[model samples]
Target: MHARPEAWILSIGNELLVGRIVNTNASWLARRLTFMGFNVSRIITIPDSIDDIVLEVRRGLGKVRVIITTGGLGPTHDDVTLEGIAKALNKNLILNSEAYEMIKEFYNRRNMPLTRERIKMAYMPEGARALRNPIGSAPGCIIEVDSTIIVSLPGVPREMEAIFEEEVKSILEIIAPKISIVECSLKTRGIPESSIAPFLEHIAKSHSNVYVKSHPLGFELDKPILELRLLVSATSEDTAKGIARSIMEDIIREVLKLGGSTSSEYCV
Candidate 1:
């Protein structure tokens, strides 16, 4: 069996750690990576500290095929993501002419003077490819270290998304797993997650490729509500969908047997 390429999303920013902002970038990247046929192994949010970024980057190297980091790519002092990544790989932070030109163009169009702080966005790890940001000034970067590819993107959601869609998506396609993923989600009532734990386990053991998980939504003592999600991957779309449908039917049958009601079934 062909193993799916594993990935990690490293979100950097003090605001995320302090709960000042939600980590939407991580979720967006996770969904995108999953759809691209990569298994997202971890989503980590850390402060805008160079030491912390270094630790995480070092940890992700050699462990996962891809590591995508969002945030700390701004012109501010706290934007040390690239610096940390450079230190982790023992590579020098050099002035990338392409990135500098992109940033210069952004400022030149608005008649804004290029300050040292603004030019800071042009420096990236040596041998990194600069990805243009269509909606923002900061240019993202892609660095290949042996078998691991690290992508550093701006913290801004729109800019990150633009760079991913226009630039990074094609690069990832070359390495993305050639598999089809089918997912099913169902809402159940009248039974708690504990009641269906055994059934889910049995299904998981029977079908190793399917991922089964339950999210409890309501109070167990009063009205039990759960969101059951199943994901399966196969070599083709028809096979994946067949497996997912079969698993969904089995789960529904088990839920009805346990005196539970299911609704809101959807596939994605």
Candidate 2:
């Protein structure tokens, strides 16, 4: 979409739905996907129910270029992400040889047997390739259906990050659009967000390629501090940064005209 590949992050876990744990996986994946030139359009959280997973996974398939799912991939009965994905794609869950070996080796080193629960991590949807997890028992997986790629990672933060870095990054790089994004955050004080709402909207409308948003850091009734983030995507890093810098300068000038003070402008 918009000349950039689109992606979605689907986080599945009962704990997440119940607020027992934070959904940091979605935010981490979102940042990675955006930095890789994919427009992360949605970050969805669903319960670890097979029906819910099937619904969301099927919704993402063929609609976005990439879909990344995290969580519910452990050895417990509640860990049924793969099963739900298989059902979503109308495929059978089969023991993946590569994944099985990875799991077996992980247990062998620990002098542990391949119990039924442990072996459960080896099953995946048909035709999916197992990604080696450098930090945990469960190996991740990637599968392509039509033009869409679906990647599933373990819920553990360290395990998910490791697999994505070691295995999934290469695959995504192959399909990611040749685009660069530059993001800059500027801090503004002595002006409330409401006072700058119109200006922000005008800036966004003026630059169709640039994304503008404001994060308020203080109460609106008082002299509020606002963190303004400007993001622009271009074919090269220099071009993207230049556009973002120009936009930031314009915003800063406008804020100064409105009796606001600006500081701490940095790009990433």
Candidate 3:
């Protein structure tokens, strides 16, 4: 069987590295991509240096099918993500007319003056398609290099999310069709991760298609509460859900046998 297409997330910005901002973009992208049936292999954070950005993008390219980068696509001098990407792909940074118009319209509507600094947001790597940013001034860009898709989005969480939901999501669905991802969790009290490791291992080994994980929910009194997450991916929703349900049932039975009492059970 062919392996699922893999994805990598690159969060660019000096602020991320300096701990000025939390890197929530990687987490959001990972969850979204996983739901879309892509395996997120790695997430890398780098400073706002053109050399560093180029190096990271080059490394991710050819390794993963999709690379989503967030941050550094701004009007300030530090915003050099487009330059780095163009350098990495041996392309030129050109004024994207569509992106320029988008930014222009945004500022024009707000009665803001269009300055040279603001126009810098319109530049993108050559042959890149501009993705409309509904909530912000900077437009995202998408480029394909050697069969790998490179997507660059704004650093602002709100703008990134808007562009992703409105544009990137559909592009991803079209490029790498969606699979049914069914997941269910069972909460067990008075059980620790150590105690449930063997059962989870057994279930995972037996049902290769199902993913089993144990999350410890801290301590209640002296014992650790545990949540077992079961996930399965299939061509159809019913098939995926049925497999997840069956695997969850088996794990629950094992938990009960191990003297752990179950409390809540639900699909997610």
Question: What lDDT does the true structure give each of the candidates?
Answer: 0.93, 0.91, 0.89
Give per-residue CA lDDT, model 1, range 1-268, as digits (tens): 2388999999999898889999889999999999789989999998889899999999989889999999999999999999999999999999999999999999999999999999999999999999999999999999999799999999999999999999999999999988988889999999988999999999988887788999999865597999999988888989989999988999999999999999999988
Question: What would the TM-score be for candidate 1 when compared with the true structure?
Answer: 0.96
Q: 218, model 1: CA deviation in Å?
A: 0.3
Clash count per candidate:
0, 0, 0
Question: Which stretches of model 2 miss by more than 4 angstroms?
Answer: none
TM-score of 2: 0.97
Which 10-residue window in model 1 sums to the lowest lDDT? 1-10
For model 2, name the residue pairs that clash.
none
Q: Is candidate 1 or candidate 2 better by lDDT?
A: 1
Where does model 1 exceed 4 Å of error?
219-221
Candidate 3, pairs of clashing residues: none
Let me know the TM-score candidate 3 reaches against the reference structure.
0.96
